[model samples]
Target: MKHIRNFCIIAHIDHGKSTLADRLLEFTSTVSERDAQAQVLDNMDIERERGITIKSHAIQMDYLLDGEKYVLNLIDTPGHVDFSYEVSRSIAACEGALLIVDSTQGIQAQTISNLYKAIEHDLHIIPVMNKMDLPNAMPDEVEDQILELIGGKREDIIHASGKTGMGIENILRAIVHDVPPPVGDSAKPLQCMIFDSVFNSFRGIIAYFKVVNGEIRKGDLVKFMATGKEYHADEVGVLRLEMEPRKMLGAGDVGYIISGIKTSKEVKVGDTITHVKGGCQNRVEGFEEVKPMVFAGVYPIDSDDYEDLRASMEKLQLNDASLTFEPESSAALGFGFRCGFLGMLHMEIIQERLEREFDMNVITTVPNVPYIVHTKKGEQVEVHNPSGLPEQTIIDWIDEPYIHAQIITKSEYIGQIMNLCLTKRGEMVKQEYLTADRVELSYNMPLAEIVFDFYDKLKSISKGYASFDYQPIGFKPAKLIKLDILLNGESVDALSTLIHFDNAQPLGRRMCEKLKELIPRQQFDIAIQAAIGSKIISRETVKAVRKDVTAKCYGGDISRKRKLLEKQKKGKKRMKQVGNVEVPQKAFMAVLKLD
Candidate 1:
């Protein structure tokens, strides 16, 4: 245990965390040259293609230092704010963290947010300036920022280039010398913290955990504290590039357990694992449960695939515990699950994964944040869907969730960033210059405002120089109203949204216009209206695909043509009464893209 080092790499997105991890693995000979690939830790196809890490990957390496062998467990974590939950879990399982900041970009919002988490966990921090090989890299400036953030000496900061493998050895030495060894006793009763889990078709569920106390071995009878379920440890081993079977894993070791549990719910992430006979009295205090920032309905494209979709989500949830869902039925989309996602990107990635990984085609509704509705009857209602909101007559006030958002950007883009945030009803809390050119802007904004396209807009406006991070700051009272989109006279519950009253009419107008373009023209005219109760705020019409009945009577008298046209009009009116409008899948998605 003295020679064991457990640590994770954390940084802002595109800060060379994966590349640095690759170099570490290569330097330690954890992965061979022939088998090595870029972003080796990002095993998912979506992650590789997007050039982003989604899941926190753990791999153990055996490094030889001065003829003495040491065990190094390195966890590569995602850098995006949406996957902060994954970072928190990874931090919990480690004794130290490698805070990698891109020398070219300096410190950003996510870097600060994740650093606080590590500090809270009392983990040792090894600050490293990555991407030193770039011609434009500003190691000195970034080192100063790092020093101010963590308050360490200048020589303590390591300058490393992941591309050229510079400083790799230095980083390794620092891990062994600086990072503290994991503290636990092997003789104590079995106590392991399950940090993550994945589903395997043939092997059942595999859980990745760190042995906090005592030892676990193969064929041991283990019980998961949260679920109160027991299963045989079919296989117990340390994680390398692949699973390596071991006779036993003792305290301070990170490894996996194959318990042959088929259901995903049987093995919960962040649960405590112990031997059945003598287990710890208390559960391991894992990180806080994830609070989803956005909520959307995910329904199978075909109704018959509902059960398949459920199974797919269960398997997906085993890997991504941040995703929360419950069964719900929509009037327009039929049966589906209301899934809570960390953000819009997380929601989009899950939708894509369901289709690509599980072959389950799905439709995702417009995303929204949960609202607290207070009623005259003195009842407080939590409404996730606009359709769930009570009538205006019965409601007293509504409170929407807010977030404390931090954005780091160049001083040149400060005006544009502030403008964008102000337009979203964001109130500026503080603004300060990290350097003469780099500024950090803090704002208190409604979570719903940034749910859709705030991140994308911020990136575009700042020319990708801005990094943003946010945390929920409870709910505040707001002037909110429920906007309902109607086809003819019938309200489509799926199209309803809870929005700020001041922006309701304009947003409603935009939705009506957007829907008119996506909804197909029917045999009769379709009245597309945006309404608040009986008041129609905006309206658009999709003219019917009319057939010229008077075309055949070209030579007839004008009166005869008029008579034919009149009859056709009457027929159209009759058809409109019975014809049911079909809302295409594209229309539902178009609602999210409304600018």
Candidate 2:
């Protein structure tokens, strides 16, 4: 156990964490040079195409240092803020972390956020500056920044280029020298921490865990501490880029155990596994359940595929424990699921996975944050969708979730960034200049404000140089009202949204205009009106198709043409009074993208 090193790589998006992991695998000969793939840890196609790690990958490696064999267990974690929970779980299962920073980019928002997470976990952090081989690399400045951010000695910082494999050997040596081996007793009853799980049709739930105490073997009966379900370990194996079966896993070893359980819900990430007969009396501490931060309604484009979509979601959720869903129905869109995600990116990934992997076409409503509604009856209710909100007469107040937003950008773009933030109802908390040319701005803003296109706007205004990160602070009381869209005096529930009273009129106007552009012309004039509690704030009209009622009377008298026009106008008024507008799916989606 003393020769084992369990560590994970943490970094901001676009940094060389995955690349560094690949090089580490090569240096240890875990994967042959001829067969090694770029970003080997990123197994999903979406990850490779997006150039980001979406899931955390674990592998066991054998390395030789100073003629001594060492067992290295490394986990490569996702760098996005949406996957922070995954990162945290990885950190909990490791004894150390490699904080990789891009030499040219210095410290990004996620870099700082992830660094603090490692610190919180009390892991030995080895700060490493990557991409030193690039022409724009400035190792000295980044070294200073690392020291300042982590408050560590300069000698502790390592420099390496993942592309050219420079400093790869030193990094390996550092792992042996700097990182502490897992500390546990092999004689103790079996206790393990599950960091991840995947479903297999042939076998079952393959739970990847780190043995914190004692040992586990194939055929041993183990129980999940969280769910209190017991199962016999059908198989135990080490992940050497592939599953290699083993009879037993000792303390400090990281491997997967197949329990023959048919459903993924039986095992959960962060659940503790222990011997069924005798094990640790208490469950392991520091197991935090993943809470979703964003909610949206997802439905299949074709109603017949609803069951297919549900099945796909179940399979996807097996891999993604952060995803939460329940049945939901919309008057316009029909039956669907109300899904919750960690963030916007997480929501997008799940939707993409359902369509691409499961071959199901889905439509997603505008994402929303849960709101606390206080009613006149002295009752508190949580509203996840605007359509589910109670009537205004019964509601006393509405509270929305807010986040502490941190944005790092060049000083030249500070003015534009501040204006954008202010427009989103952001309240300035503090602002500091990280350097003479760069600044870090902090604000308390509603989660709904930035969940949509806030990041895109920030990038555009800053010319793609700014990086933003945020975390949910808590819910705050706000003067919020639901803005409803009325189509010919009928409310469309899917088009309803909660907005601040101050910005409702302008946003309502934009929504009405956008809907006008998206909805096709009908037989009668379609009045697209935005209203707040029966008061119309903004309105736009989709004109009725004007047929040539007088075309056949071209050679007739002018009085006959007038008579025909009058009759056509009267018929149009009657159609407008009774006709129902058929809104397309695109029109509902258009309201969401309205800036």
Candidate 3:
């Protein structure tokens, strides 16, 4: 155990965390030179194509230092804020972290957020500056920033370029010298923490865990502390690029256990596993459960695929514990599932995966944050859909979720960014200058405002130089009203949304116009209107398709042409009175993207 190092890499997005992991694997000879690939830990095709890590991966390496052998377990984590829950789980299983900062970009918003998480875990942090090979590398400035953030001496900071493999050896030596070895008691009863799990078609549920106390071996009976279900360990192994069977795993070692569990819900992440015989007197402390912040209803384009969608979601959820879903039905979209996700990006990734991996075409409604509705009878209910809200007469008031947001950007664009924030109903909390050219702005705002298109707009306003991060601050009182979109005369519940009363008219108007553009012309006139209860706030019209009713009366009298036109007009009027407007699926999605 003295020669074992358990650590992970944490950083902001695009900060070379994966690249550094690759170099470390290469330097330690974990993967052969001929078999090595870029972003080896990021095994997902989506991850490789997007050049980002979406899932946390663990690998074990054997490194020889000064003719002495040492075991190094490195877990690579996702950098996006949406995957913060995944990052926390990975951190809980390690004893130390490599805090990588891009020298050219200095410190980003996510960098500060992830650093706080590492500090919360009380892990030994080794701050390293990466991307030193870039021409615009500002190691000196970034090093000063790191010193201020971590309160370390200048000499303590390590410099490395993942592209050129510079200072890779020093990084390994620093990990062995600075990061402390995992401390646990082997004599105690078995205690392990399940940081991650994956479902295998033939092997069942494979749990990735770190042994916290005692030892676990094949055929040992283990019980999940949370679920209280017992299972025999079918296999025990360590991850070395791939799973390699091991006789047993001792305390402070990271490995995988095949428990023959069939479903992920049975072997959840952040659960404790211990010996069934009660050798250990206590359960390991697990991380807080992940709660999704965004909710959306996803339905198959074809109603017959509903069962297929459910099956696909179940399989996907086996690997992603953060995703939550339940049966939901829409008046217009038919039966489907209302899914919860960590954030917008997380939701997008899931939708993309369902389509790409499962071959299911799905239509998703506008994303919403859960709202607390106080009824006239003094009862409070949480509503995830606008249609689920109570009537206006029976509601006393409604509360919406808010977030404390942080923005880091160049000083020159602060004015534009602030204006954009103000339009989204963001209140300024504080603003300070990190440097003469860089500034950090803080705000308290509704989570709904930013979840839609706020990030895209912020990037456009700042010319792609601003970085943003936010955390939920809980529910707050708000004057919000539900805006319903009506096609012809019927309300489309799937298009209903809750908006602040002050901005309802303009947003409703924009939505109606967007719907008008998206909905195709029918045989009869179509009326697109946005309403709040009985009040019509905005309206747009799609005229009926015009046909050449008089074209067939060639060389006829003018009166004959008039009679033909009059008959056609009467037919349109009758059709408009009885015909129902058919709203295309694209219309529902277009209104949500209207901003």
Candidate 4:
């Protein structure tokens, strides 16, 4: 019998997980010399440009070793902390994990985290120390860390340069020896877990499921174990990695299933796919739905793109089950989507793809951390969107989410990093020295303060030599206020916000600068100010320049100025005339740009 091996590649973000995947495809002869590229798993243009894998991708390769053909099913997992939950889910689906530790960097925070998760799952661990070709690679030190930290057998660690294709055979032999074959009764009623889904205008919705047992044909009737909503399979096919698609996927195989499904919400990840024999049995456990930690409203720059923007959101939702969005209306932005994400990277990545992939122009609202507002009536309201806030209700208490952050860096800069964390209202929970040269510092930080550029500040203060990672640490009662911007007594849609007191000052300056950059220049003196109540913390002027009227029109005719103003203000009905000056989009945008 041919052994079925299923495993995923695990590594810290930017530690060459995707790069190593491309090499795996080449060595396995999945892609010939005629067709190959770097980071082949990253199919999206934005993913390639960002040099990160935002989603998990899996591919099956047929390898021949010692005159025996073996099937190698590889899952490439994302490395960013924002997508760590998805990474965990991917790990859950696999029987084993290829723990790729950077030879140069040793074990990073994420490296430890992923390894820990893989261990918890009890998956066979195949430790592969990567980047052996790099100048900083210390294979001996990395091996020691793996053996000491993970306490795995020293011989289990496979030293390889994923970039250069060194020690691949050893890694493969380890998989065959350590990782067990897929286990299940192939003849039982169909039972599989939906790992991902995609939308098809022609076929409706296609779900990717791993068949645990039984067989599902093209006409098999299936139901979502969690929702109990039945769906008929129109096609049961395999995704040949980045190549073409296949017709059928058998037990222990990973593939997509097309069905008469309209909404992706119907076939969610972690849902079970079982044949309708007598009654559904062995239903896969649905993953706990993850609550979004960060949120922002997206509006189209051109109102005409509103429908397109909504459609784009639909497409994104189909592939990414973690994303959350709902229709939203703004006084200035009109109709758009209020989106929720796992974290900042997740938020930014979705926004960037909307503009690049869909080619839709979007003006996004500032990010807001989730909060629990206690009403005067003693009922607690969990606020995910600012628009969802109870406008008329009086809030007696408000609690904001906090994060437990552990920063490991050189001991020489321990005091510097600690001072910076304190300035941001972080409470030191623990601090310890691991060695004479390294220290670990932990803190509980307000989610709002750390939401914007916190990572950047950490790197700047650490002199770029430190490693930073954090996880949610529940909530804390906080004194918070919403800083509203008044544009001539009317609150500007882009200007209103809610911020905790401790972050209001520093965030005010950074936000002001970003607004100014995003906003265009105006024709009149526009006041750009950030404040809480009557206290103005930062101010910048959008000096409205006199409108550029041609000095000469054929023959020194200044009447051209009148015609120019009319032409410039023609399509912009949103413009308001304050005296003889016309306020355009640029002016409103300039105020937002103010530092």
Candidate 5:
């Protein structure tokens, strides 16, 4: 245990954390040169295609220094703000963290945010400046920023390039010299904290954990503290490039356990595992429960596949504990699950995974944040969907979730960024200079405002230089209204949304217009109307596919043509009253990308 070092990699998005990890693996010979690949930790196809890390990956490496063999357990964490929960989980199980910052970009929003999290955990931090080989790398400027952020000596910073494998040996030496080994007693009762888990068709559920105290062995009877279920360990192994079977895993070692647990609900991330006969008195204090930032309805295209979709989600949740869902029904879409996600990107990834991994075709409703509703009866209720809001008369007020947003960018883009936030009903909290050229702007904004296109717009306005990160700051009272979209005279519950009162009219107009372009024209005219309660806020019409009944009566008397037109108009009016509108899949997604 004294020679075992546990650490995780943390950084902002696109900071070369995974690439640096690849270098470390190669230097240690954990992965052969012939088989090694870029972003090897990002095993998912979507992650490779999009060039982002979505989940935390763990592996163990063996390093020899001064004729002594040391065990180094490394976890590669996601850099996106949407997957910050993964970083937190990774930090919880480690003794140290490698704070990787892009030299060219300096210290960005996530770099600071993740640093604070690691600091809170009392984990030893090793500041490493990555991407030093780039022609535009600003080592001197970024080193100053790192000193200001962490307040360490100038010599403490390590500069390296992940692409060229520069300073790989120095990094390894630092890990052995600076980061402390895991501390625990092998004689104590068995206790391991499960940091992550995944489902396999042949192996059931495989749980990855860091042993905190005592030791676990193969075929041992262990019980999960959270689920209170007992199972015999079918296999126990260390996480290497592959699962290396071990006779036993002592304290301070990271490994996996397969107990043949078939059900997803039986194993949970952050749960504790202990020997059933003489387990630890208290459960290991795992990380906090994940709080979902956005909510939406995910329905199977074919209603008959609802049960299959449910089963797939349960299995997926085993791999991703942050995802939460519950059964919900929609008047327009029928039976579905109301799923909660960490952000818009997280929601998109979940949708894509469901399609690719489970072969389920799903329609997702517009994403929204959970709102607290105070009623006239002195009751508080949480609303996730606009259609779930209480009657307007009974509702006293609504409180929307707010976040403390942190944006770091060059000084020149501050004005444009501020304008965009202000337009989203954000208030300036603080503005400070991180350095001579970089400024950090802090704001208090509604979570719903940034749910859709806020990140996209901020990137475009700053030319992809701004880095944004935010955390929930509780709820605040707001002048909010539920906007309902009606086709002809009937309301489409799936198209309804809860929005701020001031922006309701303009957004309603945009939504109606966007829907007009997406919804196909029918034999009868379709009246697309946006309404709030009894008052209609905006309206657009999809003209009917007219057959020109008067064409048949051409060259006849004017009265004959007029009679033909009148008959056709009456028939269209009757058709409009009875005809139902078919809302296309694109229309549901269009509302999210509305300008």
Candidate 6:
């Protein structure tokens, strides 16, 4: 019998969790010479497009270590903050994890965070110093940090490079020697944690889970602990890592299920499953209810794809539980919907998926941070989308979103970064000098400040030396506004916001220019205006082409050209027809980009 070991690879984004998975597969000979890729576990088109792992994936490989047959079940986890919940869910399914810290970079903010999450989960950790091929690889310093902070055996840190395939065998040996096999009653009632699952038309709900305690087979009936929903299993199989199916999935195994289900929705992941007879009414808790940190409404550019767009969102929700949408009628876009996401990257990812996979053109509003208000009138309310703000309600109290970010960079450029932070009203909470030349700075920064250009700003000021990691820190009260963009004195629902008082003017100027860029040349001179309630501070003019319709008209019909221009004007009319120049998607996009 093969000894089974379940493990997840945890690290910061681009720290190479997927790359580590690829190396594991190669070392174990799970994937052949021709079947290997850089990050094989990143299977989706969007994942490849964004060059990031959006979903958690699992693969099983059989490794022969020191005359022993060890079956390794590897879970590749997402490293970005948006997918942290997904990361936790995947970690819940594993008994051990390989902490892949960059050797040259040492332990970063996210590396520390990921390590803490694993420790909190009570998972045995096997730390590995990866990227030894890089010139800055400091196995000793990282090894010290792991011991000082994580309190693990410092000598256990394995030096390896997943990219160069160096010291990989030692990693395999550590997995077998350091991590223990999962111990649970395989013959008892089935109990598993549903981290994430998807529905396949051919297969019901392909729920991926860990057998926390018990055995579940093809015919087993399982009940969700939360909703009391039950689904009969059609098949249970493990991804063999070789593009083939494995015969069985048991405790300490990472794999997928193919049930006679149709939707990933039914098996809504994070729900615990137990055999009906076991009455294991106990369900796993601590699942964070992630609120969308950023808000944007989306609509089809072409009116005919309305139904298609709805269907696309519906299908997308099955795989992405975080992408949220609700009915939102836009004055300009007609019947569109408001969507919520964790961040700008999340918004872009969803938009890209709709365009690439669903093949639909879309127009998106400016991304805004959500706010929760508690009025003195003893009424509490939440405003997710800026367009959903009520006009008549008397303002009593207001709150805005904020985040706690951990940043690590060289000490030489701290002044530059500090100056940048001051511009955003960032409060420095703490600072620590890790080495002679490096420092770690922690700050309480508004989510809005970091969402758009902070990452790029940090990189530029630090000379590409600074690194960062952050998580949402909940809401804080601040002076904010729903600065509406009015075209020709009409309010465009698409150009609205919840902004800090200080940023209003700069943002206003940026919005005006973006509108000018996105708007096409028209037959009439149009005024592009930016305002905060009737106060127009910045303005631009889109001089319409004097004679866009040439001397030659088809069928002597300037009437046809007039009809075309009328259609264009009608589209602008849907927008808050401010002045004559139409504000295109680019205008709303100004806030999302950095100068």
Model 3 Cα displacement at 473 (Å)? 1.2
Q: List where candidate 3 sits over 4 angstroms from the true fold.
A: 279-281, 555-580
Candidate models: Cα lDDT each: 0.93, 0.89, 0.90, 0.75, 0.94, 0.76
Mark the regions of model 2 whose C-alpha exceeds 4 Å error after superposition: 557-580
> How much does candidate 1 score in TM-score?
0.99
TM-score of 5: 0.98
The TM-scores, one per candidate, come to 0.99, 0.95, 0.96, 0.87, 0.98, 0.89
Give the alpha carbon lDDT tens digit for every residue of 223-313 in model 1: 9999899988989999999999999999999999998889998878899999999788888896788888899999998999999999999
Instruction: Kindly state the number of residue pairs that clash in model 3.
Output: 0
Model 5 residue 290 distance off true place after TM-score fit, in angstroms: 0.8
User: Where in model 4 is the C-alpha error above 4 Å?
Assistant: 65-67, 200-203, 226-232, 242-248, 260-262, 386-393, 505-524, 533-595
Lowest summed lDDT across 10 adjacent residues in model 6 is found at 573-582
Which tens-of-lDDT digit does each residue in 1-595 have in candidate 6? 2399888999877777788789889878888989888788888887887789988888888888778788888889888777776777767777789988877776777777887888888888888888889887777877787677677566677888888888888888888887878877677666677777664556555667777666666677777776677766666777775324455556556666665665434656677778777646577564665577777789888777888898788777767777788877787877777888877667888888888878988998877777777776767689877766655356676787778888889899999999998898899999999887789999999987777778789889998778888887878888877676665566777877777888888877877777777778765556767776667878877775654433345576667878876776675555434444356666566556747
lDDT of 3 by residue, 1-595 (tens): 9999999999988999999999999988898988899999888889999998999999999989998999999999999989988898888988899999999999989999988988888899999999999999998889988998899799889999999999899889999998999999889888898888887879988989999889999999889887889999999999999899999999999999997887656877778889889656666785887888999999999999998898889878877889999999999989999999999889989988898889999998988999999998999999999999988999999999999999999899999999999999999999999887889999999998998889889889988789999999999999999999998889998889998999889989999989888888988889989999999988999988879887788885799999998898899989888887767778767766786
Candidate 5 per-residue C-alpha lDDT over 1-595 given as tens digits, one digit per residue, 9 for 90 to 100: 8899999999999999999999999999999978898888889999999999999999999999999999999999999999999999999999899999999999999999999999999999999999999999999999999999999898989999999999888888899999999989999999999999999999999999999999999999999999899999989999988899999999999999998989999998989999999999798885899999999999999999999999999999988989999999999999999999999999999999999999999999999999999999999999999988999999999999999999999999999999999999999999999888899999999999999999999999999999999999999999999999999989999989999999999999999999999999999989999999999989999998979887776595799988988898899889888888989999999888999
Task: Please identify model 5 stretches exceeding 4 Å from their true place.
Answer: 554-567
lDDT score at residue 467, model 5, on the 0-100 scale: 98
lDDT of 3 at 127: 92
Per-residue error (Å), model 3, residue 94: 0.8
Per-residue lDDT of 366 in model 4: 68
**Winning model by lDDT:** 5
lDDT of 2 by residue, 442-494 (tens): 99999888888898899899987888888889999999999999999999887
